[model samples]
Target: MKKLKQIVNEVKDRIAEQTPPAQLTDLLWQLICYPPKMPLRLQQEQFLNQAETFSVTVHDEYFTKKDLQINGFKWGNGKRRVLITHGWGSKAADFTELIAALQENPNLEIITFDAPANGSSDGELSNFLLFVEAAKAIIQKTGAPHVVIGHSFGAMANVVALNDLHITPSLLVSLTPFILLKENFIKSMTTVGVPADAQEAFLQDFERKYSIPASYFNMPDLYKFDDKLNHWLAYDEHDMMLPYSYLKEFLEAHPTIRSRNYDNVGHERIIKSAQVINNVVEEVNKAIAN
Candidate 1:
């Protein structure tokens, strides 16, 4: 029994010492396979990390949910308020640059939140609904007419809130949004243990884990062809998660949505770029005026 224990300990030590497998290649393949979803998730995470270091900075603070104190930053008593959300795994800080840019106008109030478990916000990692709830909280606390913009997962959260849950953003902007490619997402969800032919089990597990309906994965078709989307601030020339073909299809399905695509830009850079900041400010001004 003693020798058996020794062997087990050695095995565990070796397992711990060995280098972990590289998830990068696997992640890339997943992007290639899904074309859009996984890439959106990855970009959001990286964007948030950048915000923590060098990218856009937000009015970041930790606040109590019970009273919503220590809420994020604000400047200029601008009549038009804007609530911005970061992509998946992103913090409010990711939109710092945009916040700064828009704040310069002196006619706009900027609000941003660390989606649950992000930035200084306190919450469970699995509470995906926190994204939408936080956005609403920002608007209510500020008490201003607001336009809401989100990147990637934040965009999806906006959709669920506006379309599925019925919370309206005076003006809504979704960047590099994920609207479909359900099967690939389900494949990733398998890590939690759903098997083939067990779609119901997957939905239940998803709801329990993230509080999101599986129908989010089974979203309706909404893409229209547009070479202009390739110009979006968030597209990589070499490695694109969702190529132009996909965006064209997505826009076609949702023509009522207003959007602009910039040239040869990838999602994260677009979020952090000066040009995008200007573009957002321009649009927010228009939204407020109209």
Candidate 2:
């Protein structure tokens, strides 16, 4: 894998040298938007097979606002709805343990979906804006949930979608959220040996395509909640995908957002932690009770 990455970087360098600036940026944009298809693991397969499945048709702004069908799962038929969203490259079944734990509550109707290009959804490419649209569609279909829980990139999308839709749930839980979209994209491009000039050009092209600056996606500027909303943020200190410093900086700026940090759960493992699942269930139980 290491050797492969080195070869890929070398090829990227050669492309930068050979291709015109516009073509290079366009290629990079395409590469970044398309997520690799991951095979369903045993656990994910088992969870999906056991759950009730449904499909939602949503218009994706990333694809010129074209309509696409997204797959979703439901675990309960309770009055209080709780929506769960998975991270990038992750399917709804990835929340197997968490959803199983949450299902113990008969009063809660737990729901989740696969974003476009992920899981059983129909697409070859996806972006954060598409995720926001999917969330909105599911929320509209199921009615506003009492609690919305999001993991990693899904967490960021939930924040933006809830704010944009003006649907303030009683509780919002963000687990290991990826907060810096623009900064992280640049860092990823740099790691892949994309030239700094080409990176800048790609950002400009992205802005033109999206009709908004990528900086607008950053959590600090995008996060908004009403007084009635209760927000909970949980993250791991040793998250390898997202540095703790980013969460720290975000918390420091917005001191009032409720947050907690764990020691060894890391990024992905945090989702399967018994402690994390229990806390999330407890929060949801509390919300519905009130």
Q: What would the per-residue lDDT of candidate 1 be over residues 44-132, giving only the tens digit for each residue?
A: 45544433121122222222234222235454566777767677656666675676677667777666666554555543232335555
Q: For residue 207, give model 1's deviation from the true position in Å.
A: 5.3
For model 1, state the Cα shift of residue 247 in Å: 3.3
Question: What TM-score does candidate 2 reach?
Answer: 0.91
In terms of lDDT, model 2 sits at 0.84
Q: How close is candidate 1 to the true structure, as a TM-score?
A: 0.60
CA displacement after TM-score superposition, residue 111 of candidate 2 (Å): 0.4
* Tens-digit lDDT string for candidate 2 (1-290): 34334445654866657766566775676556766556789878987888888888978767546789999889889999999999987888888889999889999899999999887898867899899989999988888988999999999999999998988898899999998998878877777777777788899999998899888888887888744568888999888877889889988877767888888898988898999989988888898999
Each model's lDDT comes to: 0.51, 0.84
